[model samples]
Target chain A: MSETNSPSPMRILYIEDNPLIAFHVEQMIEDLGHVFAGSLDSFAELQKQFASLEMDGALVDIDLADGATGPQAAAWLQERGIPAIFVTGQRQVAAEHGDVSLGTITKPVSSSELAAKLELFR
Target chain B: MNTIEDKSLPALDQVLILAPYRKDADYLGRLLAEHEINVRAGARIDDLARMLHPSPGVLVATHEALTPDALATVAAHLETQPSWAEMPIVVLLDRASRPDQVRAELGRVWPRARLLFYQRPVTAVELVSGVQSALLVRLRQRDVRDHIAQEVELRRELNHRVKNILASVTSIFEMTRRGATSIDAFADDFRGRLGALDKVHSAVFHSEGDTVSIAEIAELTFDPYRLSGMDRIVANGPPVTLSREAGTTLALCLHELTTNAIKYGALSHPDGRVQFAWNLSQDETPELAISWKESGGPDVEEPSRAGYGTRYVRSALAGMFGQKPVIAFEADGLRCEARGVFSRVAGNQ
Candidate 1:
């Protein structure tokens, strides 16, 4: 069992659309000592990283650039055995797709929640 | 409801950073890894969504990472989505000390976006704080929306149950009236009662549970026999919706007249017919006059005793119109006329 307070080093790929949220979440990821595999906002960019990078888990948002949503991104990451968390500001979208097993962090993600979700990958 | 904690951060995993702009993307990734975030770098936004596994908890994107058209596309999708969707964006802005400039830019492209404006050369802590704050807001918003959805669903269930109860009551009325003595004679009486209820229901339905329509009373009263091809049953009136009680009363009055016609007046014969017309008489006074005339029926005379139908008609119409209806049993046919005051509904007037 992963402790919520002690998150282990894990590779993460983040896909979000808001800059301020990305900046804050990125800071929290580092503050907690987690490794960020990559951050993306579009499907095409995510695809490129999948071809090359090794990742432990992923955090995705449903809305993204280039007409790519977080679910589409999570699907790709799931195929690679990379655990993905949805960091979203929209609760309806989260609950609508809540049946999925992946972790979901509502936006304005705190360092604590991000760390807690990242611990699942460990 | 869950809060992000400092102890949860981890390090040592390889991270691949992906962003459109070189300076901000590399800076964000390095800043995370430096805090022991364990990060790698990716080249573009599309590759990050498609290829990255166990997707990253935080995605960092600058204006340069996507074309303006692409950002616009993302914005459009966001509009349809709930408030907590974590599509976080960290727009790398030129360092401007003034708040007015920042506000102006916020009004421009980031109007409703959950964004953090990072002036050039953002520090590691500031970047981390910005990202965490944005994500935190997303979490709070999610909780609120969930609460609202639950409440909406409950209200709809309540509405459904209420409709079921009313339907059950209607069934009882139908069943009880069917078993009464003199079923053929009771048919007209039963229909009149049912018509009264229908008139009330129609009035209430329009106000969404508040008022009714006078025009509905006219329609409901005449609707049943409209297909009978009786040219004498003519109706001419201006349209107006009334209160629920008012509509029911008027409907009953009309029902009584029609029943009388079928049994003893104009409608009892092949050539007999009834002419009905009503209109608002004065703008300032706000009164209405409705006339009903029957022609071509057997010669008529006053009955020995006024029945329940007559009393019902008089009471119901008088209450709504503020006066008893003028009723005449002529030798050739029966004619009835009524006058009353009515107010216009707010929106219709």
Candidate 2:
């Protein structure tokens, strides 16, 4: 997908409770040459708007505004045929729910690393 | 030395009586009831075994109540007693029976029980006093159990809070790094964000309840700016309290706004000024409305793209308020406003 004739940009949704982090990640997603599908702070919010959210993939944090509902959100997204990547500082928590995501990207995520992970959706 | 009436002590006033004779059981129950002690009596070994689950304060038995089956049942119950417990057993001996023989037999069968003996001709006053003392010991044992439970609960809560704080710090660190242009910039911004988080944490910690006042959060967030004596920022709001989570979110949002203002908005110029205010409504669904308006700065033009601070202000407030906040980069200055159900943000209902 990194070749000259690469696939179109993926629409990536972010699930994070911290707004600053979410916005920063949104910018990073755009920097990686992908579409920022938007962000949700909790799994409950995701569930409420699941039908309306247009995304090709997801970046999920282990914790959310509604406590630890990120894992459930990933599972819910996976069930809907939407792929997800765990983007969080909590590697242990992400590892525990690893099956739902393509891979894990630890926090303080780099642009290059995020660019590489976005290929999983392609 | 504490008495049974001490409110802090657990109430161990229930007496369990095992007597094969109906008259004896009835008399004992009536006597204990007169002293305002709750009493339960059983005339059979099976009945006694069935009533042993709650582990009454004291067990009183007649001489004939010590059938082999009853002894085994009582032994089994005492075996399961917690290390802190020693179920007190009072045995009423017939005057003709050998007291030492009966005491030795009971001691062998019920190893951990505190044994009290009363001869058949004993006075009611003496029996009641013996039972009361036994109940007091039971109450003390209960106190120990309660203390252990409370300690365990507190430890669990402390661990949970520590984990949450660490996670919040990690998020702040990662996001700050993402937006930094240089090492010095990263360190400065990171430190400021951490300081903001730490301030809100302490404020919430010191709050009497699990909620902090909105004014308290705003005051703390803007305190450093106020200390610089620039005096360009103004903040005023009604008395509104927020849950610990809501307080943390609001504090971080304010931090983002203040930093942005200092860097590129109203606070960027000497003559620039900012107004921060909020109001509570009394409609069917009570709402809280907040606005941040900047003016008198250099001619503001909408950036070709949204910056980290602007994006955070929009998304964070949206997540917290459950609605998208309006952010307008006007020709003169920046304006941001949002509103949401007050009870939901406060987490009161």
Q: What is the fnat of model 2 with respect to the true interface contacts?
A: 0.39
- Where does candidate 2 stray beyond 4 Å? A1-47, A55-122, B1-13, B34-36, B46-50, B66-76, B83-86, B93-117, B129-133, B136-140, B347-349
* Model 1 chain B lDDT-worst window of ten: B4-13
lDDT of 2 by residue, B198-259 (tens): 89889988985777888898889888888998688888988888888778888888898899
Which regions in candidate 1 have their CA more than 4 angstroms from the true location? A1-122, B1-181, B199-216, B344-349
The two-chain DockQ for each candidate, comma-separated, is 0.01, 0.33
Residue B11's lDDT within candidate 1 is: 17
Best by lDDT: 2
Per-residue lDDT tens digits for candidate 1, residues A1-122, read: 12234535666767764332343454456557776554555666678647777777778887765553677677767776777777765667766765443668865555567766777777
Residues B1-349, candidate 1: write the lDDT tens digits.
Answer: 3332324322112334456667656777777766665556654655443433332334455545546654554455445444544445555655545546754764566455655577666777887777666555655555555566666766875684354335424432433343345777567566666666666665667777546555666666777787666546777778765654455456666777887888888899998878877777667878777788889888888888665455445534544453557777888787777776665121232
